[model samples]
Target: MKPFVKWAGGKTRLLKEIEQRLPADFDEWENVAYVGPFVGGGAVLCHMLEHHNNITRVIINDINDVLIEAYRFIQDDPGPIISGLKEMESIYNALSNEEQKQMYYTSRKTFNDMDGIDCQKIILFLFLNQTCFNGLYRENTKGEFNVPHGKYKNHRILNESNLWEIHDALQTVDILQGNFETVGRRLLREHVFFYLDPPYRPIVEKGNMFTMYDRTGFNDSHQERLKEMCDYIDRRGWHFMLSNSDSRSSDGQSYFDNLYNGYIINRIEVTRFINTYNATQRRPKEVLITNYQPPQQ
Candidate 1:
């Protein structure tokens, strides 16, 4: 569903490479299922709906609360929510610099302290995402959205047509928030296609690997656990694909090497874009690891 929110580690850029690795008779498979354990921006989910209508059901899970909330809102009340967001956008656009600053802080304060599904919570979440630095979702120890206002003042908070399309796509899917391991256990069906896009191990030099937004960073140990999980799934004969950083870090040899050494793997180069305050540090490279063997033409 176009990812209900903008996630820091989203893989919207790698959709084409990911699509290329799908099974040839993917549509013929009965009871086809798409499971994303760590569904971020849901770029893959949206892409699947647009391209692969054969998928009977989709299961999306995440550990982030705000993200789940946004997704649930879209699934249940997309029309009203989109309208509200558009109204909010208009209001936000009309505000002066000081007013915008005031709105950000006020919304942040209310969201941090409150613990209910009210208009305020949803509005605050939308406001923060629209105004936050690069639409980055960062939270403190107390689970407060703390990113500063971004430079873009005319952000599109809501797209009605897209929301309508996403809502239709979501009708055939189930959404949840929890650990990936749990998702693995609950999924009993065979021939399911799983796309695992966990947080990538950072390649930046001044790597504050553990950031406020991502408190539970995907470390070497977690990567090992993921390897084990994928192995277990492989034994069960379920088709799956995984994506991660191709380069190595202080942790170990490229994430692809450590995780999918014995499994069928393919390398695809993707153009990574980074338009932040420091624009000079952006570049692109190949991201590795996969299990699906696409048919040769």
Candidate 2:
């Protein structure tokens, strides 16, 4: 099952690399729990639940309330969400290209001003993601949906079957919203698997530095906090993996090498940017850090 909406920094392209590098004990354990602290796009979460029979419980948490709300609406009941999508599709398809663009900005404006990702409003969130420029989620400093309208051909707005599949797969998933620390409370004695994909730190100083995905900022201090969480999780004997930028900082220093010392770090060449459509900003490499060794064939 695919994600309900297209997300920035989504792991859709890297799922295969991630699956091959999962902890060795995953197959050995009869009933394992899979957890993702920053489930942007949820490509990995869907993959794990769909492909692995050993996974009994899946806990997917993210800081974005709108994204989480989309997940919950899909999981609990996609009818309203689906209905909303159909309405948007009908209205969008009936209009001229110029009118569609006009409606797009108006819809975006309505979405950004709202405080919560309410049931009615969440569908517009999905619509904007589908029709916005390059399908990327970019908000301004004031938290407005600022991306221009995307002129894509024959976009599938309301995919009913896929949504149903996602809903069924989410039956085992517990969607939590808050800081990454929220998942710490759900830890247990069972053999647990952690896939932590926090927002990637900028490789170069002049980079856009996606300090804030929503309203709050995730800076170097947040990265440090993530490292600390990894340490605590590692000490607790939970198997874990993380993804981040592999580039050197502006000072020509390796950022993740020292942060994830004593851990296995593999560089994967990625053709797409972690969170953007800017061709100039697309870095070639990404760091995949793991605490446990994968069983080799």
Candidate 3:
């Protein structure tokens, strides 16, 4: 049950670190809801559903309405999306290299112009992710999808079985499209475990932020607001784990350490798999901050 789309700041590579830090009592907990505030790519979401049976309820929310809508489309019925992707794949695979490039831009325009929920929007979202540059999602200030074609060869644009698996996995889950605070307010009374993966702050000052995830970019102020939410969640005795870029790369700064004071923050090494804009901007470290100490393994 892998994520249906390629997402920047995906947790696939960090899953091992995340799993190792789960509360030791997690498996013993009953009827706990698993909440994902920034459910991009949904790698961790799928992983939790696959491995943790204690997570009887799941709530996933994102700021991107289109992405959430895609999730709903798949959860409700993946048949049309599957059909659209198969047709798209058949046509895309037969085109020449030049033809593919032209088709990519044209399809991208159509995707950008599209509004509201429909099967085609979901189809184009998945298609652009597979064919887009670096399998990355970027947007202009206007929120249009702006990644160029990746010129990939023999890419499997449609993974039919995986879609079915995702559909089945998401059957009982609750999906929401809103800001993180909205999610926080709604979960105030739930017995839940939270995994918060916000957009990575720039590794260096004003240099390489990947916060274009939505038209409304996440900035220092938003980070502060999230920290406030974490404080509220922590005071309520809820368990949460958060991931973000280690800001001490070149400037020797401890921004997150100062923000999440008194918490257990582990600086873990990570390979830069996808270079979004520049090669030099790919930092090799990230931090996992947890409110409660993970039990010894």
Estimate every model's Cα lDDT from 0 to 1: 0.71, 0.81, 0.86
The order of the candidates by TM-score, greatest first, is 3, 2, 1
TM-score of each: 0.87, 0.93, 0.95
How does model 1 score by TM-score? 0.87
In order, what is each prediction's RMSD in angstroms? Answer: 2.9, 2.0, 1.9
lDDT tens digits, residues 117-154, model 2?
Answer: 68878899889989987677766677777878997555
TM-score of 2: 0.93
lDDT tens digits, residue span 1-297, model 3: 799998988988888889999988788888888989999999999999999997888889999888999999999999999999999999998999998899899999999998775889889989999999878888899889899999977678999999999999999999999979767555545467889999888766666677788889888899999999888788878889999887643466788988898999988876666864234645577899999898665
lDDT of 2: 0.81
How much is the lDDT of residue 16 in candidate 3?
A: 89
lDDT of 1 at 232: 76
Ranking by lDDT: 3, 2, 1
Which structure among the candidates has the greatest lDDT? 3
